[model samples]
Target chain A: MKTATFLNRDEFLNHWQGHRKLTRRTIEKFPEEEFFTFSIGGMRTFGELVKELLTISVPGLEGIVNKDDKPFSHDIELADKAAALKMWDEQTEQINELYNKISDEELYETFNLFGQYKDQTNNNLMYFHDNEIHHRAQGFVYLRALGIEPPFFWER
Target chain B: MKTATFLNRDEFLNHWQGHRKLTRRTIEKFPEEEFFTFSIGGMRTFGELVKELLTISVPGLEGIVNKDDKPFSHDIELADKAAALKMWDEQTEQINELYNKISDEELYETFNLFGQYKDQTNNNLMYFHDNEIHHRAQGFVYLRALGIEPPFFWER
Candidate 1:
């Protein structure tokens, strides 16, 4: 069974960054009130969605790099949308720093991600990406529900 | 510039297959009419979103394996939701066939995807996965708007 090389480190990081850019734009387009309160059919608001992304990426990566099995938790409470964005930027930098610690060899070695998802380091990274896009798409819907056009998906 | 190695071929394929399973579940959750007609904020309906995914993956992989540079086009005319699912399954088979042709050595080689988006074969493949997640997210939103609960995001 040959394993596929879907992305190298820099390319994967760039891919993640592109999605983050589009996600940030989605966050910006939300009206402050809707950011926290809007929901269609009992789904979470865009703010909550953004918080989920923030929670997963930084801590997940930290655990991967440190090999520390801290059960995943979003204990760090963000005050509001502004705080979320600031933390997003901070995590982006943190990702760069910690991501560098992962060598090409280590990417193939399986690690228990967040003490749960045991897969190759690279697969775990892709999970972070897939998770973000899933949430961001929800944000896109929230924008549309509010009669706002989202930044073009391709713009990322 | 450090490059990352994530999943080998089998792992990457499995990861993609998992997402496809979740996406298929999302499509199934949509009420037949809502799947085609429902939209939030003037966005493309779920049917059209599926069309975009169908348009890209198989052809993109075909081009990568064949080194064929044909401009991107949605030549397959899907008549309705059922037709889209049939085609979706067809493309899934097509992906397996074409994907198997791509040797690990070729994974690092750059391919011009859809006659644009020049990148390594691996990155191009990731684009396919990312684009699917982006569009599928929209479908999830559509489901929620229609008062339908989408499949769990982590179910993949």
Candidate 2:
């Protein structure tokens, strides 16, 4: 895991947060009724998808930070969209907290997420950054389907 | 936007298939009875997630190439997993066909996808790559839950 060093932590956080803000804006524009409605078959309603995004990142990043592949619990449920949003806000704060704890050297270290796919200890951290952009695209579509315009994607 | 050089088209296809193969392998490692039953609450069932992944990348990529943001109309009745998988396979083939038509230069052009989100066309391509890796992380955990070891993430 040589350095995936194009951007330092601060720069990465800025871009990451910028994109998430766009995602949040997209979430904001949706009609509340369709929040839980799946637009296409097998797709979670926009609300369900948003809730899933909130759970994955902070916990996912925690896994990356410690390089510890923690077992995901079955109890990872949100009561409602409001609860999900509160969870999201809390997770955002956690991201700010956890990200600052990482050293520049740590980002380049191989992350051993064990008992699952990826045995390598050396891994590029940028995969996480890139993954968020990917999910946000799905978010982009939900915005359009709701007849709202998504914020400019390249503002970051 | 600067040139967003990535895995070549062939490289991209190979990696895409490779990831899917590993994903299927992970899915298979689980008992058949649990395939449709598994869930991490806010997360999707492995069966459901795989079906949806099949829908997003290929069709999503194809839409980007044609600059047509066609939502999956047939999936409107999408509660069934089998139908979703069929749509997934068709979309995969469609992606392979459309992806072949994309020249190296077209990767970087400005793409007005539905006239909403716009960016250097090259970065748009990278979004396709990044999104899959992100979702695949969840699959890895689903694998672990069923006592399966997923393939190395960077087997590419």
For residues B29-138, what per-residue lDDT tens digits would candidate 1 score against the true structure?
A: 77887766888889888888887788888888888889998887865687777888787788778888899899888888877777888877887787788888989988
What class would a CAPRI assessor give candidate 1's docking? medium
Candidate 1 per-residue C-alpha lDDT over A29-48 given as tens digits, one digit per residue, 9 for 90 to 100 = 88888788899888887787
For every prediction, compared with the true complex, DockQ reads: 0.68, 0.05
- Per-model TM-score (chain A alone): 0.93, 0.77
Worst window of 10 by summed lDDT in candidate 1 chain B: B1-10
Tell me the spans in candidate 2 whose CA falls farther than 4 Å from its real position. A1-4, A73-75, A117-124, B1-156
* TM-score for predicted model 1 compared with the true structure: 0.91
DockQ (0 to 1) for model 1: 0.68
Clashing pairs in 2: A35-A47, A41-B78, A110-A121, A110-A122, A110-A123
- Show the lowest summed lDDT stretch of 10 residues, model 2 chain A: A1-10
